[model samples]
Target: MTWETVPLRSVARVDAVHVAPEAISTSDVYVGLEHIGRNGAIDETYYPAAREIKSSKNRFDGRHILYGKLRPNLAKVARPRERGVCSTDIYPILPGSSVDRAYLAHFLLSPEAVGFAAARTAGVNLPRVSWSALGELPIPLPPLAEQRRIAAILDEADALRLTAICRLRLFQKLEESAFELVLSVSR
Candidate 1:
């Protein structure tokens, strides 16, 4: 399908939620930028009780896309299913009518979008892309129907890739254990 390229701002609201730390309850769900995995996996282990957070954070709901604006090369993006507060470094983007949330998240994680964000980042050690720059990113927008189709296809691929990575890690661990056993037996 033919897609029309448009600036990200045209189809999404970047960092739409900005609230003070005190504004949120300590018991609320918290998502740090580090909690966002490179493979669109939200690190469930990183959720600290809202009271544990000392600084301000962005609030997002199920409808928004959580994007790691800091160190964009990591390509961290996810659509959280719950309402909660997230690290200020992450932008809680809301997609417009023409764009689907899943589609936007996948696009943000794509190599083209990631590279575009990386090129616009500022700072040498801990670079971050500003909301303005992120909003200006060029996105190839397809029809809503086509976008859903693309997103579904990408999601399936991502799930398979994650499964393979997990299996590989498990195998490596088993190999290490076997090698250790062999060395102990020889000793």
Candidate 2:
């Protein structure tokens, strides 16, 4: 089936709600670029209080897809689980009614979109993909049902990959213990 391609802006818009550092409550969660992982992984463990944030930040709800503008090649994107504030260097994008949020996040995390962002980024020390440039990215649109299905599959794959990684680490640790036991017995 042929999918209609449209500009990213047609499916999502950057939420521009900026909150001053002083305005943010001390208990508020703050997410910086460091808190976001490549390929839509989020480091939820790093929950810094708002008081730790020195600069102005953008407010985002769970519905927002946070995309890191700086160093776009790293593809720092995340779907936050709760309301929080993020660094100004990140854009909190909200999907349009026609688009599924998870689908949009996966699309943005795709290598194609990451390459497009990397090419469009400017600045030497702090290369970034501006909202205008990112908005112009071509998105392959499918029916809403298909979009959700694809997103679900991708999410499942991600979960499986994480499980595999954890298992590999556990095996490595077990091997190390076994080796140590063997060496001790020889002694």
Candidate 3:
């Protein structure tokens, strides 16, 4: 069955929820656009709001995905590995359980979807995504089973990419070691 493409505003409310600054006693989960990965992984570390929540900040279950509405091209988004909170800049997308987050996240990262965002982003000296246009953004859908498969494939590919990066780093370290050894011997 074909899933309907509803505006994000229809799927769930995308309003910003504020955290009082006085609530925090210690530094905790900090999230910002810098934490967002171009590949859609979010690393919540030292976010400004994290310093403000005493008991808890804006916590989100892994089921919900976060988006960076500030910059469209960044493709900054992620589904929390566990329940966690983030800064006010990140939008917590609380869709009904029927909506597959993995599916939604995958769709959000599509070049076509990001392209729409690029066309609509408006600003003067600093470019900011058009949040209203982003709200009404169209999302494509596939069967739930297909969505799961696609997510799995994506995860596997991501693992490989990370592995390749590690190998490249090791190779570079070896190259540096070899150069150092040559210099020492010559001395």
How high is each candidate's TM-score? Answer: 0.89, 0.96, 0.80
- Per-residue CA lDDT of model 3 for 3-105, tens digit only, reads 6677765555553455554654344455556777888777655455434445333545666777766667777777776655565556777765545677777
Q: In terms of TM-score, which candidate is stronger, 1 or 2?
A: 2
User: Each candidate's lDDT (Cα)?
Assistant: 0.87, 0.91, 0.68
Candidate 1's displacement at residue 2, Å, is 2.3
Clashing pairs in 1: 26-51
User: Per-residue CA lDDT of candidate 2, range 31-112, in tens?
Assistant: 8899887757778787777667788889999999999999989989999888889999999999999899999999999999
Model 1: worst 10 consecutive residues (lDDT sum): 44-53
Residue 148 shift from truth in candidate 1, angstroms: 0.7
Highest lDDT model number: 2
* Cα misplacement distance, residue 141 of candidate 1 (Å): 1.5
Which scores greater on TM-score, model 1 or model 3? 1
| Alpha-carbon runs more than 4 Å astray in model 2 | none
Supply candidate 3's per-residue lDDT for 8: 60
Q: Higher-lDDT candidate among 2 and 3?
A: 2
